[model samples]
Target chain A: MAKLDASGFLIDLDGTVFRGQELIDGAAEAIHTLQSLGKSVVFLSNRGNLSRAMCRKKLLGAGIRTDERSIVLSSSVTASFLKKHYPLSKVWVLGEKGLTDELALAGVAMAQKPQAADWLVISLHETVTYEDLNLAFKAASSGARIIATNRDRSFPNEGGHAMDVAGMIGAIEASAGAKTELVIGKPSWLMAEAACKALGLPPGECAIIGDSLESDIAMGRLYGMKSVLVLTGSAKLGEPRLYEPDIVLGSIKDLTELAKEGILL
Target chain B: MAKLDASGFLIDLDGTVFRGQELIDGAAEAIHTLQSLGKSVVFLSNRGNLSRAMCRKKLLGAGIRTDERSIVLSSSVTASFLKKHYPLSKVWVLGEKGLTDELALAGVAMAQKPQAADWLVISLHETVTYEDLNLAFKAASSGARIIATNRDRSFPNEGGHAMDVAGMIGAIEASAGAKTELVIGKPSWLMAEAACKALGLPPGECAIIGDSLESDIAMGRLYGMKSVLVLTGSAKLGEPRLYEPDIVLGSIKDLTELAKEGILL
Candidate 1:
């Protein structure tokens, strides 16, 4: 079999670079080496809670220098999708500031009342109130199309796995008697498009590297990109695999050696 | 096939007797007449928000004279289930006062922290806060057994269909990455058993009356009771049926005529 040759990489954030404020081992050095070789590397996250600027700051805090332009988030992808497809629609949001801020930055119309909504966007809000859930339900049942940020059920947190947007989506869709019309993150074509757009590379020329098999590896397989599974996060060795990756690494730290081997050329 | 000769009746509330604040026509007369015939009539409701006392008050306002003994609610059923099975288990709740009140009334242990809980009970809470959801997520993820009050996605309200316990259940299950282990209400055998126990009659001698096909009618079919569907609720004639009832009535008002024809006798 031929070895993978990629000009750019779409990297996951949580479970890839850092988890719960703790940076992964060799993460900064690997990214530095990849950048030193002039290989395009774009960090991708399905988190609607972190805007690109916020993610950039966090990466910088971890000694990884990446501009906001190099970070692509689910919020950003959703914003762009809404801006292009639902430009005139009044969007109601059940989300945190990062998602709402991105939508506003993209010139999407925001609706304060459920009755005024043409679209209802869902994301995770750990502090979401019952009244807020009702509003989302009302907007959705009243004919607003639902757009979800991601399908992640939970993510590893300091305590354990914290509920993600999938919970919110599950609740709203059940109440609204409808399913989400679109999703803007991993495994969705929309997010794949957004990441490739940020890297300015074709799908075949890029590799998606992350710790999740169902999400990261699935996204790569669905979009014709080489997939690299790392073990720094959620996935473990010898676990039952639902999605297989083209390559496996102990962690993102191993990328430096792969770069030295001309894989990043 | 032999005709139904029920000695007792299991009646639903919301859609069967009333909607929002408006009492359905003849609901009071129907119950009064059934009681006059010396036949047992137990009001069965999947609502975890209402206790038997609260339901009695509401029915009183509707001109129906029924004691708490004649009412069987999901909360009451859940409390009984917990008291019998998990008597020593500390329970945490993502629910309203009705559910907690019933649990407390039944002497079910209550825990305030996720770590301290052995069971997590879920019910509808219109005013539940986000922190509460996280607590539920925490408890469920930490291996607390999930017990849901009902699976109702929505119910008829003043404006339209309102989101119900299903939303809460959906959110928690997705977040916790587990399905609910038990449901204490309609379509669950537990509720059927509760209703029949309240009436002090065998299932074959009782008829279940309500407007929902999936819940009420399905419950009757699952248990050994006769089922009656009424038109004064969310269901409509000619709709594709997922469950088939034994009989159909225009409304509860028609019960009086059915009573006159020896059906209630």
Candidate 2:
């Protein structure tokens, strides 16, 4: 089969380019190679702990030059999607400062407390407490729409791995007897759409590169993009057979070779 | 407050005396302290992966001395409990060899996989597969009585951990759109009654000591047993306030002192 032409690149962060501030050896070079070939690139991350500005700072700090327009974070996408779908909804957030700020920027009103909420957005919160859990349970059980940011149970941390929003949401869902109606992050179609919109290209005209099968490859498959599994991060040397992406490479260093191969017809 | 009368100790293993192979630091000393006070102590674990002999061997190896008579694995209790409640019932189990053997010993016939099963018993299995998940889901959705050994997501491993039967059952329950009717492990009144019956003591007369507030302390609270929280395992320092156990101690070293003070009334 001939390689499909793609207009842009949609990349994932944690398991793709870098894991907790350590950039994959050749990932940045791949993006530069794509840019030099006249292709747009946008990075998407499900981590809601940091703002988009902070993400750009970190990426650039890791030697990968990035600007505000070159990224779309899950927090931003989720907020925008929720605003578009449920305009002026009274939303309750079980998340951090980034999530709250993003929702406000999207023109969504934050519910004062659980009892005053019409919808519930479950996300990762560093200051998660029992009172927050109790309030979330109340809101969810009272029939609030439960929207999760992602289903990733854990993520890389500076010191040690930590339970992400998925773990917290799992406990809340169990207690409230409600399932998340929508997930708006990596592995979700919404995050891909956000990236495509940023690049002014259709999802079908993009290539997704990441190191994890369940998230990056799965997202690429869902969005009709060419998926490249890289071994620099979460994808181990012998684990690519499980997802079966369109391309398997050692690192982003091979992007020039892929471009030269005329696969992007 | 006056010292409370205590009959014997009923312990839960998973997050209590030990997590996986290593015993809680003071768990062995706690048992020795209880034994020196002439209080009978029995080890109980909800893990259905091993037989009674295996459980005994493992506990002994971990410094918590136990004989077959001094231990109660959930599989054996489940088999006996099912036989007592539903004589001639065809039981379907998604578990290991130990579970099947225990049911056989109870004179209960194993039902036809999932198609003809009357009840579903979920237990920990090292060999959990997609086929097993499908079978469990089918049986649960087909109006079978759903019962689980416990509600723990992951079992403690030597270093990290592995997803346990509880997580597997949670997935099945999610797909079936129904929660299990009963959890037969510690903190549940069913298994607590069985332990009380074996000790030939009234529920109010028995006492439980373990490291988990949700399971062990909750069991004691549910069955009217004096609950003692020991910090040799899963329960951290501030966990007791959430469950409110009757007695809170850092370790089992205080058992002899309490007994001498006529706490075992």
The per-model DockQ list reads: 0.59, 0.03
Task: Estimate, for each residue in A1-265, the C-alpha lDDT of model 2 and write its tens digit.
Answer: 3475788888878767886768777777877888888888898888775568778888888777878777888888888888998897899888888888788888988888676788898787756654465567667767898887776655566733444676557645665667888888777777887888889998788888887888888888887888988777667876435557887878767776777888755
Compose the digit string of candidate 1's lDDT tens values, residues A1-265: 2365788989998898887799999999999987888789999989887788788889999999988888889999899898998778899999989888899899999987897899999998878888789889999888999988888888777777777888898888876777888877888888888889989999999999999998899999999999999999889999998888988899999888877776655
Give the TM-score, chain B only, in order for the candidates: 0.95, 0.85
- In candidate 2, which residue pairs clash? none
Q: Rate the local accuracy (lDDT) of all candidates.
A: 0.87, 0.74
Tens-digit lDDT track for model 1 on B1-265? 2255789999999889988778988899988888888888899999998778888899999898888888889999999999998889899999988888889999999987887899999999888887788788889888999998888888777666678998998888876787888988888898998888889999999999999998899999989799999988878999998888988899988889887776654
What TM-score would chain B of candidate 2 score versus the native chain B? 0.85
